[model samples]
Target chain A: MTVTASVSTVSSPECGAGRPDGEYILIPAFNEAGKIGEVIAGLSACGYTRVVVVDDGSRDDTAGRARRAGAVVLRHPINCGVGAATATGLAYLSNVGAVAAATFDADGQHDPRDLAAVFAPIYDDGADVVIGSRMLNPEGMPRVRRIAQRLASWSTFLLFGQWSTDSQSGLKAFSRRAIGTIQLKTNRYEVCSEIIAEIRRRKLVMREVPVRAIYTAYSLSKGQGFTVGLKTLARLFIDRILHW
Target chain B: MHPIQWIMLVFAAIAEIAVVAGFRRGKIAAKGIFFWTVLWLLVGLVAVWPDSTYIFARWAGITRGADLVLYLGFLAVFFLLFRHTLRMEKIERDLAALVRVLALRDAPEQTNQPRADGDK
Candidate 1:
């Protein structure tokens, strides 16, 4: 895909009213009705209007809640995975002529204030991909979750030969070229690592920035527990072995 | 021949014939029928010559012929189970993709809830 110079050449719009210069916020959610509305409201208050939510086959009224929140909802009829949902969101953003895209978790863990910091590099043409790293400022992060996130970072380094402080962070900002070109194959949580692998393979310029995480009991429950984290790691390793 | 040996031979012959008939009737694939027929013929051979299993077991470093056959059978069963599980996961993934595509295509153009952000 030939990325025209027009992609990064577009300037970021001042946060006043309408959709800002093709910068979109994508939320990949599954059964996150309880928090999705509040998250969207926060982003809307911050003047980020181009929000797209991929409802990942939730049994609940997640799509309804997201639509109510004024987000363009893309439904997945069955629960695919976070990876698939994110891919779907990105595909839609690219289709809608977005110059840059930012992915935020739907579980209310991400601070909406940090969306600008994550997407700034892409908006300014300073980086192709900006990863919001929790490791940089892990205040209020649980110890067990911190350890698992570290292990994920280390594993990503070992597998993809590129190391970042946090590899599984849900908050990521992508340039139009990155969002349009990166091919995602995995349909599960392993897509987090796959994104890193894609960045490495394509030799895209990547930067990591500090971002605050809101770790309430509710958000903590949505995170990968010990067993789930282990399973995710095993699946990622198997995917690497399979060259997927 | 011993009564048990005769019984084994008759059963194996029946099984082999049944597999061939299944293939002819299009109830089983050619490869599956061939595998079952060979398995049944092997059973008949073992029954006719009980010493053959002992020779095979010795080659495999197994002291008991029955133990060796049991181990091999367990291995085959486990492998088949593993394949079945993997196939099931693939099907589930495919089904999820289908559902996602349908949802994206068929969902209402206008949401029931009012547009919260207000951008067209």
Candidate 2:
């Protein structure tokens, strides 16, 4: 697990020392004020400090709650969608000098306790990007979500020849280089599918790590159901094929 | 000419006349050079009077004089649109630069962590 020091000189002393392992946590949220504080607290307790919580035009005080929870907050004036929020977070990471950034859910479905599970490969194991796969250990998975996940995963695999254990999981990590390439034009939920498709098309080194998924009634209701799933698939096709 | 076509022609002529007058007066952003360009474009659609000439022409065919005037009018409109597109491009560039800077400012500082993926 020895990383070459080729990039050390390019990084400033602050960047080199503060994040020698090249890691940061990026959380994009939309009106999750009720849940963001707890999520941030959990991550902070686990020593995950670099939390970038993007408030996607929440009428409520999602940003304020995240700030109070010690997570740095970014706000979108209007709801641009999850894709734009993630892009804003990544831009922030690159802007303020982070080596890499990971996207985690704000709905409390994902555990901040497992921060290293997704980040370790990119930081220590020399992988370009890593995905946190709940399907690898889908003990708490609901039937509806499982079906939706399977459809999304299959379509991506069929279209882009990119197959992973979990395609719809929001928990994922990205090296700086990977984020740079993800700067294409996507401003909504379709962007996650777009990222997977792009990652496969570029053949960037990616691996999936088995992780726990908490699917309480709250988190399950927060997810898109059948109709939205159909719409998401349609959008993914247009973006990956027609629009690519 | 139909009343609208007549009005458009009158407006276009006034605008074109204003441009000439401005050139003579040596005015750049004056009530002529730029504004006339805009006015010409706005009223340019009038020159395409597809039904106007048919209804108003002597032989139900486009008159040579009217046709020539309409051609020039459209040319003026297109030229203005091109100029405006260039201006819009400049504004878009500035906007993109500003957005990139604002998005990147105040990024969270990074440090080592125990990950949430539950990985070693």
Candidate 3:
């Protein structure tokens, strides 16, 4: 199967034949009281028919707001990591027989337009997994995210010998293979890095597509603290070195 | 060797085991594991001690083992909430950033609440 050239459109198949990759937009949110509504509406408008918001125990109104935005809501009742939330979302989609599942951030850095890029390869059966990369356009990407992406890329290089441009992009599309093989266990932001590590370890058919990224003051404020970066390092240690 | 003391010992043992089980089962996360493991050890220690709860209560200036029992059960709920609060804070921060990104892009707000910080 040939990889789709780009994520240019959000058009659906004329019919859902033999479970033709039912599209589910999975939003795993923690607090996200500010951005979830528009995310749900945007994906819905952008042609995502089923949107599932997993509220990872936000003390705020993340779940309530998500429900208001026409998404099916699942609350964690306490804070689990984004990894856990994403795992929950994947589990649900798999259980219900979703053919294709796209994970979009509740925090709003992703362009729904890029969904096609992330999923097109998987949608066309060319790759089992698709990752979005801001690294493709370095000048267009912001400085802080560039730093994070580099860290993600290099760590993945060290782990799997697979050099990914942006291993940590929140936007990813999965084929049934991804949903089944990549077992996600981390509950924090580090899970983004962990997913790529798993992909490299498993040697899954993976591709990175250039996608547009949006960075705003709010996202910057929420960007990982040094401790989060440290946590990512710690996970690398635990997973690769310590063998814990 | 009285029947009541033996009964109390069995009850305490069961309670301590339950606390350990909760930790093992991950009815709580890491914090849960650490807290309950320490607690279960303490309960087990007290259960095997020569002194009874009545004597400890009178001498130690505390109540019966009921307090200890209640503490173990309630700890799980509280810790779950603590982790939840921290998770909420982080998510709120991420959402705020994402919202600003979308808002700047001129996308519509999806929440019933106003555009500014909701629920702090």
Candidate 4:
């Protein structure tokens, strides 16, 4: 497939020459045709060009839109969960010899401006993984979401034995070592907590940066509901018992 | 024999016949046929002699044969469910790996190249 060109210019100073050469932004999307293009465009507008979108068997034109928005699109033939998509993206990045990689949500909840901040610790501070925490400055976050995020963080700490301000955050940067070392087995939303477990087991240096979340109605609707959260918790518990 | 014992015996006989038929038709492997045959034989034995379980129940310090059977049934169900879940998870992981490999193979040739728009 031919890669399209972004019309916007790189205006962010963070996207200038000092940016690492082999850094890539990985976006895991499932039926996100409406928002994937805009997310890619936003990243492109911020001058973050090395974007890879793993289309998780989207029935809509998600892959097409991402390709049109100037992203390297990787299409899964079947509908695997976000965890599988992220793992696929990481494998690709590792195979391509990427220096660093950051995962961005295709639902447009994450801000493109925060990409630099997320990657800062990886490059500047030598962190293996940098998580962009919305809880750090959750000024405008909805009450229910805030509570849910806190509960998820607590559960992740209890189950995986790692504490984070936002354990389920989609915005995370990984260094090359982290990318090659971390192997994901879980294929669902539970992968977020599994990543925390990996951080502890692999002894990877992890840091959290405060990042703003753009919580539109659509974005909010796309997030995990009560049933999904319960299922995620159950699967995480099963994974812990079986694997750990 | 009690009416319930008669019904269970008939059901076990029918199941055993089905298992034999499956084995004859080559639909079931030798190991699977052996397992099912043995399981059905045990079921028939229990159906024929419900009081036989009471001896084992007493040996295990259980009060009632029915209670022992119920407990064993629950254990069997749970064990099968756990095995099924593990098998399903392995299949999912295998499928995900296959999909990932296919996606990687089909990725764009210009994956690492700078976009033509000079954004990089």
Best by TM-score: 4
In candidate 1, how many clashes are counted? Answer: 1
Docking verdict class for candidate 3: incorrect
Write model 2 residue lDDT over B76-114, tens digit each, in one string.
889888677556645643554444345455333433442
Best by lDDT: 4
lDDT tens string, model 2, A125-202?
A: 676667788777778788777877888889877766677667777888888777766664466666667677767656
Which is the winner by lDDT between candidate 2 and candidate 4? 4
Over the stretch B1-120, how does candidate 4's per-residue lDDT look in tens digits? 999999989998999899999989999899989888887887888999988999989998999988998998899899889989998999999999999999999987744554513343
lDDT of 1 by residue, A1-244 (tens): 2211112212223344454567788899999988899999988887777678889989999999888888888888778888888877777666666788899999989887777777777756568888888888888888988989999999988987777788999999999888888877678887888888888888787877788899998988886778878888887776676575
All candidates' TM-scores?
A: 0.82, 0.64, 0.62, 0.89
Quality of candidate 4's docking, in CAPRI categories?
medium
DockQ (C-alpha based) per candidate is 0.32, 0.07, 0.02, 0.49
Counted clashes in each candidate structure: 1, 9, 14, 0
After superposing candidate 1 on the true structure, give the runs of residues whose Cα lies further than 4 Å from its correct spot: A1-19, B1-51, B107-116
C-alpha lDDT of residue A73 in model 1: 83
Candidate 4 residue A224 Cα shift, in angstroms, is 1.5
> Cα deviation in Å at residue A33, candidate 4?
0.9
CAPRI-style grade of the A/B interface in model 2: incorrect
TM-score of chain B of 1: 0.69
- Give per-residue CA lDDT, model 1, range B33-73, as digits (tens): 87788889889998899888999999999999989878988
Worst ten-residue run, lDDT, model 2 chain A? A5-14
What is the lDDT for A57 in model 3?
71
Sort by DockQ, best first: what order? Answer: 4, 1, 2, 3
